[model samples]
Target: MTGGSPGRQDIGPVRQSVDGSTLSTSLEAAAARLRRRFGGRLLEEAVFRGELTYVVAPSDWLRVLAYCRSAPALSFDRLDCLMGDHLPERAERPFEVVAHLTSHTHGHRLRVKTALAEGESLPTVTGLWPSAGFDERETWEMYGIAFEGHPDLRRLLTTEDFEGYPLRKDFPLQGTVGGRIRIDLRGKI
Candidate 1:
């Protein structure tokens, strides 16, 4: 009932910092800092099972993430995961690339994701976090998403002759391009 807003009403007395200034939870503060820094580019916010997720637009993906890695308040220096997913249910925007970031300095975790419309590609984060090299390559091969400036994006798991993106939701269950195994006719079986 104190310090409320029109869209998001405050629940109770806002927590106070040691200096007696009103404060929000650390995660809430992080979200607010990102919101201030990104404005509309930071698209949506979701908290599921106590985990914070920030969905940014693909247009500003690289800039926002770079800010996260460098900003003093945010400093999301470690890139834990950079992967892609196909969500047919989303319909309009079916492809999504998610990055998990951790701030060892502040002991905070954030999940950042950007939705892509099937054929679109995201900018490479290898320059920001060199550890993302392998994950970006794998995501590129599996989801058919290219990291625009990746240094050495080659096949990580599948072969060069692989026809389709195996990790896509629409990919065949058994196999697509690879030769099928004849279990019954094979003498080894």
Candidate 2:
């Protein structure tokens, strides 16, 4: 299992007995199970380019995350990281949330990504994984994505009085007041 970066390889498909029939496969199978259990809400499946990622609708994110953690084959117990992405021009959902999950026992990793439109909110997964608290908060502070169930949802990396999300693709790189290049020239000549 691999996450985030390209070149990560998933373990080859393996056979496993679910019932009377022997239906065995790779991460694709796991993704199928999730989709079947969750219905047609899943957006993208088997999208294992840079990482073994499953993109779900923002509304189904909480359920999907829980299923990934409890699913027999894809037992992702560790929450490695959670990040946010900004895609301004995308007609669909603009903000993307990526969660990296790892199973130490199985030596496998899985990435779950969900897209939320502007002003939309995603359910928090901190109930399943305590480490998600800080990660989700940071994502909210940086990308303006809100985690509905986060206990202490607040700005993490930015000041409380910060005006806008600094990481959104639409957010200007330069300051609004002066339109000046906000470059750090402290050590550069």
Candidate 3:
């Protein structure tokens, strides 16, 4: 990754050239380039609460992550975290998987989020970042999301006997109640 201003550890923004081409000014520029390349499929492109976040379609997730790693200005060599959120009640997309990417060399951070419909499986990134294994496992166990090509996909935090997904909105919070009991009144009377 290209070094930018002093104290700016990670990728920052990039500037435009006189020929109407874009140039890397900082890490933000790298993200902008990704947005330009993906176009309408790119959902969110702003830094949220101090983290660079990019939400894209599930089909384009792998390509987007690959681009982020390949782009010189934003070489996020590490997959910091990968997790999924359950939003079954939403009228639109009901599920989302969030991947956090970071570059120790550039000291930059980027978040990639992909939306998936019910029962959809997301492409595995473990091949690209081995650290994603545990994260993917946790997501799968909690959200019932399948990461295609994951080496050992299994329940991480839950027991093997557990039946339904605990994190999904549709999952019932409590098990069925058996029956009601009548209180004895002869002793009190």
Candidate 4:
């Protein structure tokens, strides 16, 4: 295993993090399995509300995902969801691609994230999870973030003639955006 990987063989004894809180055996096992594959490419790991999330490097995105799906030890075969986030605050890498993966064999789930710049695109994961077909298209349409290898990446929700990303933060709040239909319910529900 490479340096910065999380595992018993490489790092040894993952019973607790620096905070000294015990982690579930499954999480440790999953981390170890991932370490065996990707090593130190994992940037950060966080657990909130008992859910584990890993921040991955954009360059390693495709390989990490492939490992998650194919590795027997990790077997994260389920692509629960895939979405994109636009964080204008982070200028260097403002766009984020988040994948929710679940392993039925391990009975655990993991959230993986990778950040990219405005023009950068991620390799499509549709090859790993067929369910990601529409999700990637929808995300690309809404966020204006491209999926480089997506087979059919055309707008799924918006018309082919539509212009601009509607879900982007900077998208016009009021106006005829991409010929959108609007009903002005003047201050009343």
Cα lDDT, all candidates: 0.76, 0.70, 0.71, 0.77
Better of 1 and 2 by TM-score: 1
2 against 3, candidate with superior lDDT: 3
On the 0 to 100 scale, the lDDT of residue 81 in model 1 is: 95
Q: Estimate each model's TM-score.
A: 0.79, 0.73, 0.74, 0.82
lDDT string for model 2 (38-80, tens) is: 5455554444332356667666788889988888777889999
Model 4 alpha-carbon drift over 4 Å, by segment = 1-23, 180-189
Error of 1 at 62 (Å): 0.5
Best-to-worst lDDT order? 4, 1, 3, 2
Look at candidate 2 and give me any clashing residue pairs: none
What does the lDDT come to for candidate 3? 0.71
Error of 2 at 86 (Å): 0.8
After superposition on all C-alphas, the RMSD of every candidate to the true structure, in Å, is: 9.1, 10.0, 13.3, 7.1
Sort by TM-score, best first: what order?
4, 1, 3, 2
> Model 4 — which ten-residue stretch has the worst lDDT?
1-10
Q: Measured by TM-score, how close is model 4 to the native structure? A: 0.82
Clashes of 4: 0
TM-score of 1: 0.79
